[model samples]
Target chain A: MLKHTPFHDFHVQQGAKLVDFAGWEMPLLYRSILDEHEQTRKSGSIFDVSHMGRLHFSGKDAVTFLNKVLTRNISEQKAGQSRYSLVCNESGGVMDDVIISRDVKNWILVCNASNREKLVKHFTKVRHDLDLDFDMSDQTEGTAMVALQGPKVIERVAGVLPVDIKALKRYQFESGSYMGMLKFTIFRSGYTGEDGVEVIIPAKIAGMAIKLIAGKTDKPDATIKPAGLGARDTLRLEAGMPLYGHELTQTIDPLSAGLGWAVDLNKDFIGVEPLRKIQADGPKRRLVGLELEGQRIARQGTPVLLNGQPIGEVTSGTMSPTLQKSIAMAYVDAAHATEGTTLAADLKGTQVPAKVVKLPFYKRAQ
Target chain B: MLRKKAMPDAPKDYRYLESHEWHKREADGTITLGITQIAADELTDITYVALPKVGDTVTANQRWGDIESVKATSDLYTGVSGTIAAVNNELTKNPGLVNSDPYNAGWMIKIKPSNAGEFDKLLSMDDYRKKTGH
Candidate 1:
């Protein structure tokens, strides 16, 4: 059975085309994917991301337990702060990429929706074996998440909310009440590489708050529109954010995927040994971004060629709505992964010429 | 696959296949083939279209071409067995025409019917509509 979010009716009312995504019925687009993607880059847009998983870890050993399992250091995070971390298996392969938010008494971990059940099962096994005092609770069912993203999201959101969103630094969050509902967390963080906010609110009161927040018009700059998963993919692809199944998987190690910054070697984590070895002797394949010469878009599973020989495969590709060019992310031989290196992607019968550009094809001008 | 949905505006005289392919018989006894509007919408911006060469024999329900969109790759199937008479050469330069006029200028191929009997086996426009939940 497909699960529906509380915002399902709202999306339909907004003329969204709903699709089955990661076991949940979610909107693929409210209007044209091109319009939504362009609006997000030129102005701002809102997304219903309630399908993502949310886990709350509390008790005295919350920090200790997370630090032991996650690749990033959770113990060093200050209150009201969020950090990107990777959950890895014994071989240093990334299970899923998550954001760990540390509050006063509990640690909130936000992960990919598809990995939620599997992550919970993995956590249960670990909790039993480690004999820790940490309590893991699945709070995804009751949470309604929305992302306000773009260059003008800050001003758009500040117009409605009573709090000054500018005061909240990146990766920082604060609790606020909207429409008499005390349950809310406004995080100055988003998947798109832009100035944006992700709001988590109680499921029952989400519709009212979403209407109030998105209904207002920024007259001088019409920046906010409802975006869907289609826009989400293009926006994140331009921003160079790695999707779990695409750039990362249980079989790929974190260090090879250009996520070494998130790993702290000083701390001993669940997948430390393999990571240490991989760090010492660099990984065979490196994830890099490709900028195709023409409008021909490469696709996932398309072979990456170096001098007419297959090296690696493309994980994700799309026509960047903002750049108006074809861009893709692929894993290639480390030697040819450097920026400016020449490569070709076998797109059906033709091999499209491409260059290894920097990860993000578009970055928010701050 | 393009789910069969009822498009009341769609020409009821034509028939459709489950693979989202649509076929309409002209008064001249030739079959004009193209993707439905709903199928074209699902594909968004049609970038490149790979069509079968003219004069090639195609079987009923067999794939005749591939449609490449910014979002995904989808197979274009033959709704009826026929010999390829002509291909939409304009789509190679202006693929967006598929989304703009899928029923007319966006017609992918013209097939010379090999088995005119296959027409009876296809779904009517109403059946196609009900199957797609349109």
Candidate 2:
């Protein structure tokens, strides 16, 4: 069964293209993909991200429990702060990358919607074997999440939010009221490479929250717009953030996916032994960003070639709306994954020239 | 040519394919083919178009080439079998014409119809809009 978010009716009313994503009916685009991407880069845009999984762990040993199951050291995280961490299966493969937030009363986990059930099962199995005292509660159905991202993010959100969003540092969150009616938990973090905030509120008030951020009426406003999965994918690609299935997979290790900073081998956790061995030996294939030289767009599954020999396949690619150039991510032999390395992408029948450039084709102005 | 949100309408005298290809029997009895305005609207910001070369034989309902928009890549299916007479080479340098002028500057190819009767099977404007569920 395809589940619908709280903002499904609103997206349909705005003429969004809805698609089945991980059994959830999600909006792919509210307007043109390029227009939405540029809007989010220049000004600010809102996204309905309620489909992500939300879990709460409460008790004295909540931090200790998370530290054992997750790759990052969660015990060091201060209250009101969020840290990006990964959950790995026993085989040392990434099960999911999540945001671990430490609150005064409990620890919260925000994981990918597709991997939510699997993570829950993994957590249950881990708790069964370990001495842990914490209550794991699935709060996804009752929660609604929205992201406000871009250069003018704070300025745009300040109109509807009573809190001073500018005071919130990166990865820090605050509880406040939205338009002084509903309580909202907003954090200064986003998938897009921009200064932004993500708001988590009750599902019952999701429609009202969207209206407050997107404006009540259907008037074309440049300051704030409703972006969709299409823009979200492109923005994250430009930001060099690895998507779960694309960059980091069951067989792909985090060290090779350019996420070594997120994994701490010094800490004892699930899948740490295999990760340590892989880290010591070094990964054979590494992820890198590619910039196609010509106008031809390299799509997913397009083969990457070096000197006419097939080396790897493209994971995600698009004509970057910000740069007006084609960009892609691929896992190539570690030797070929270097800046300024010449490469080619076999697009359809034609071989388009490409170059391995630095990750993150776009960055926000500080 | 400058781009607008809505592309120009197909030549009213031309026949349209359910898949959005425009088929026009030119004054010289040769047929010209290109995508329709609705197709251009759906595939906005076309970055590349791999057009069929001259003398390449195209079969009805078969893909002759491909067009890549920023959003997706779609196959260009020929509605009528024909021997290609010419292609818009300028489109290689400027593919945005696919959205700016889908019927004029975006015209893909000219061909001598292999089966002239195939044109009658093509869809009308109303039929195309119905097929696309517009």
Candidate 3:
């Protein structure tokens, strides 16, 4: 059985087509993927990301435990600030990508839904070594996460929550109350390449809050439509972001996936040795963005060919809503991975011509 | 290519199938083919269409083409055994025509039937409705 979110019925009421994705029964789209995608790019859209995992760490040695567990340095982060981080195995391969936030008394780590149980087990085993009094809890079941994205999301969300959100910089969050009834944390961060906020609230009041936000008619320009995982995939692809299972996995290192900037060599952390070796010897294969010449969108695991020989495989592909052209990301042999180089992606029996472009196929207007 | 208006009824001119495909017997021996409204509604907005070669022989109850949407992909089955005569090339540019007008301009393929007698094996309007659960 697939897990259902608190807003499952609300999605069905709004004409969403539901499908199972990574064990969660979520909406694929309400009406049309293109319409929802365009709406998010032009104005705003709301997504029910409640299925994502949230874990809280509270202990006297919280900072010490985090420094040992996370690849990025978490000891220096000021309270109320968040940063992207990674969990890796001893071999220097990525285990999971996470966002680390420092609260006053505890540290909050948000992880991907599919990796929740596995990550909990990994952290449990390493907890005893840090010499800290810490309690780890998976708060995903009781939390409701909603993302309001696009340029006007701040103004629309600020009308309801009691906080001066204007002062919140990117990746910064603060705890605030909504309608004097619910306490939650609002983060100025989102997966989509847009200005947005992700609100984590109590699961009980989730449906009511969504209803209230969707019912707002005074903000005409801020139209809130329910988006599903389908649009979410396409949106993130256009932004040149990597999916955990697709572009990122335990077998691949961050350097090969164009994420070298996230690693800090000064910190002694797990997976540092292999990462350093990969940086020195260069990765066998590198990830690249493909701008397809035809309309047939490449799919994951599709073979990439150069000079009629298989060179790599596509990790993610879709018809980009922002660019209107077919776009894809794939890992190919480093010898053939260069911007402006021509490649072919085998789709079924046909080979579609593609050009190796820079990372992002679509960029938000400056 | 001209767009077809949604008729009040499935244009009485075309033959219907239980699997929600439409066949239009032309003045010539050839026939034009497309998916019906029921099938289009089920498939939603068509993203890509893959049709067989023009001269390939298509057997009844066999796969001739395929259509894909964001969520699902379904094979286009042959209702009558025939030789591929022509295909709607416009669909390459605008596949949404399959969703907007499935009977006329959205016609997928044209066929020169080898066994015209087999046409009787397909469903009528009443039988098609029952088979589609609509």
Error of 2 at B51 (Å): 1.8
Deviating ranges (above 4 Å) for candidate 1: A179-182, A216-222, A293-295, A348-350, B1-8, B25-31, B51-61, B80-90, B110-123, B130-134
Q: What TM-score goes with each of the models?
A: 0.90, 0.91, 0.89
Ranking by DockQ: 2, 1, 3
Query: Which is better, 1 or 2, measured by DockQ?
Result: 2
Measured by DockQ, the strongest candidate is 2
lDDT of 3 at A28: 77
Instruction: Provide the lowest-lDDT 10-residue window in model 3 chain B.
Output: B1-10
Model 3 stretches astray by more than 4 angstroms:
A129-132, A216-222, B1-31, B36-45, B52-56, B71-75, B103-105, B123-134
Residue ranges of candidate 2 with Cα displaced over 4 Å:
A178-181, B1-18, B36-45, B54-56, B85-106, B124-134
- Model 2, DockQ value? 0.34
Worst lDDT run of 10 residues, candidate 1 chain A, spans A214-223
Write out the backbone clash pairs for model 2.
Answer: none
Best by TM-score: 2
Q: Ranking by lDDT, best first?
A: 1, 2, 3
DockQ of 1: 0.24
Instruction: Give one digit per residue, the lDDT tens place, for model 3 in B4-114.
Output: 222325666577776677887888968788988767756655778888889999988888888876545678887889899998999988888888888878999999999
TM-score of chain B of 3: 0.88
lDDT of each: 0.86, 0.85, 0.82
